[model samples]
Target chain A: MADEVILLDFPLSAFGMRVRIALAEKGVKYEYREEADFMKRIKSDLLLKMNPVHKKIPVLIHNGKPVCESLIIVQYIDEVWKDKSPWLPSDPYQRAQARFWTDFADKKIYGDSRSVWSTKGEEREAFLENFKVLEAELGDKPFFVSDTFGFADIALVTFYGWFYSIKTFGQFSIEAECPTIVAWAKRCMQRESIARTLPD
Target chain B: MADEVILLDFPLSAFGMRVRIALAEKGVKYEYREEADFMKRIKSDLLLKMNPVHKKIPVLIHNGKPVCESLIIVQYIDEVWKDKSPWLPSDPYQRAQARFWTDFADKKIYGDSRSVWSTKGEEREAFLENFKVLEAELGDKPFFVSDTFGFADIALVTFYGWFYSIKTFGQFSIEAECPTIVAWAKRCMQRESIARTLPD
Candidate 1:
């Protein structure tokens, strides 16, 4: 039986973009339905029914079962489409490390990115320092986990959109401070999966 | 050769308690190191080295490598210890569902628990409403996912400690509002893994 996959999405959401990149990387054919009125607080009934708990996109409806949460959706996409290179690492510890960083991106980086552009002085500096922490994690690796381009890369690279915003908004350079991070992001953007998400 | 396992923990922490329950469920014997001075902002050097990212516990150091984050650590414990019954669901969809709720607990419920105790009026009512959301998820099921006691249960039941605190502080009953949730907690509390976490 052919698999039916539907992604309830909003184009500008980094979380939705994570799923989009993962699906694109794995070469999964899915119906991408943009929640056109998402910003206006109008959710489709299908979305509400599919993801009653959160009532948010990007909900991945596979064969009628809904997977909410962007990281979980990326993972579901990785697990179901086993023909491609896995998005997450293979080893348990490495996998844990990958998840830890992704969770960090979700918890810490996501929150900081929202206000960094609007804030001033010490607040913005603290936010920039958080990026340096990520740069330190990236280190000499071409990717966050060793040289492999997978989960951690997908999770962090989606924020390139927000990075551009922060830089443009403040007339500052993230690349000026965290060269390695910018370089690593550029490396990830070279991939077809990532490039399509932020095609601007 | 024996498996060298150690858990960096704090007795009062819901996050640390999640790991302790999983380890206890798997019956994996290891050194349990309490972060006695954690509340004092004094961290052990081992913890500092093990989880340099967060500098937090409970870090499960197995064979000298660290796994941080409670949900990730619980998943790691399930993956590493082959002899035990699995903590997470095997099916990809169910696994995604389990991960979703656990993430919800970490992000939402964890925050709500902290202030619910000290809150009044509408804030306290809204906090109780969150448990009602959880109760709706549980429904008639013995556990969060199903009849099995595993990851989702471990993630939430640790908050039973805070449940008591909120009840005591607010001079109200959570069970009165969320009986199914309270019943499920009682069911989980009967297990040795959970019983030991909140022996008081």
Candidate 2:
């Protein structure tokens, strides 16, 4: 148990959920402080001092310093806990490829998928098209990184949590549009670390 | 001299330029092949094979595996040549900070900064406002990293090159609009590696 690690998080946030999975997988114990009143109380004064700009959740306060950004936090955890279960590949090229896909998920998939939640007509169609692109790329692969469940897999899985919340389950329909990716997401979630941290 | 590394790039591209600077900085030698005239040359089979989805440049082919995206490519180079010269910090917390800033440059700065290129108006003003956010975050720091140039520095400098072709430079005036960032860019460009690669 590392007393220095404190995660200021909420279970509902996909960003915070991702960090929780990383910590669980790494088997690193830390104080989990739920920020219940972010809108009202503004949560921890320590968190505010830690990240002044964004001042958002999913803040990982480690040994007194705070690190923001979900994916960035995962990368940090991977680097620090390298001796533990590896989140990223040891090979540089493989690691870069992993990052590329992770970034693709963040920029292309996350943004477009979120749009599907609030849109209709041509906008919804455009969102589905983006989904198709991801599906086409992910075709038949069990994980984004070939066989292993790495950082990219974790990122994709984190976003997939949004699937249940959006029309992705009924309207957008991942099985029809992106059957392969859907299966991939399902496979990733089966992992205990991931299964435990998914949002309600 | 190792001759196996291959880079699929176009000199005129800002993304490609980032890779060139990284390679130069690390003194990594590689064979370069530019993608010919994008539109008319779409029929080219080589590119389709190298990058099927995005079909973007700055792809590094190491040991026959193609790695796409500029930041990913830079990270690959850093990881491969980790011992030569460290472009990113080794400390996990510091690395996360670097990554957070780098993602900010990609999503916010380089992202919104592109509006300046699109035939002026409210969009261009939006772009200037985006640049101000970066300038404000940068403040008086000599470098984004404060003393040494790192991943975030490379990202911003590459974006600065893009600013040249955009109409925004004339409209906002770098020296006047954001002198600190302009000075920071100039200072980063002074480095031998950055100087050799930044566009004329």
- Give me the TM-scores for chain A across all models, comma-separated: 0.94, 0.87
Query: What TM-score would you report for chain A in candidate 1?
Result: 0.94
- DockQ for every model, please: 0.84, 0.66
Cα miss at B156, model 1 (Å)?
A: 0.6
| Candidate 2 lDDT, A99-194, residue by residue in tens | 878887777777666567554668778777767877876777777765678898878788777666564443666567677778887887788888
lDDT of 1 by residue, A103-129 (tens): 888777886765586556777787788
The runs of at least 3 residues in candidate 2 whose Cα sits more than 4 Å from the true structure, single-residue gaps closed, are A33-49, A115-142, A165-170, A176-179, B36-44, B117-142, B162-170
What TM-score quantifies how close candidate 2 is to the native fold?
A: 0.83
Which DockQ-derived CAPRI band holds candidate 2? medium
If you assessed candidate 1 against the hidden native complex, which CAPRI class would it receive?
high
**For each candidate, C-alpha RMSD in Å?**
1.8, 3.7
Error of 2 at A184 (Å): 3.3
For candidate 1, lDDT tens digit of each residue in B27-140?
Answer: 899998985365687788888888887888889999988899888999898888868778777788888888888887976788666557654677777777788899888989
Provide the lowest-lDDT 10-residue window in model 2 chain B.
B36-45
The prediction achieving the highest DockQ against the true structure is 1
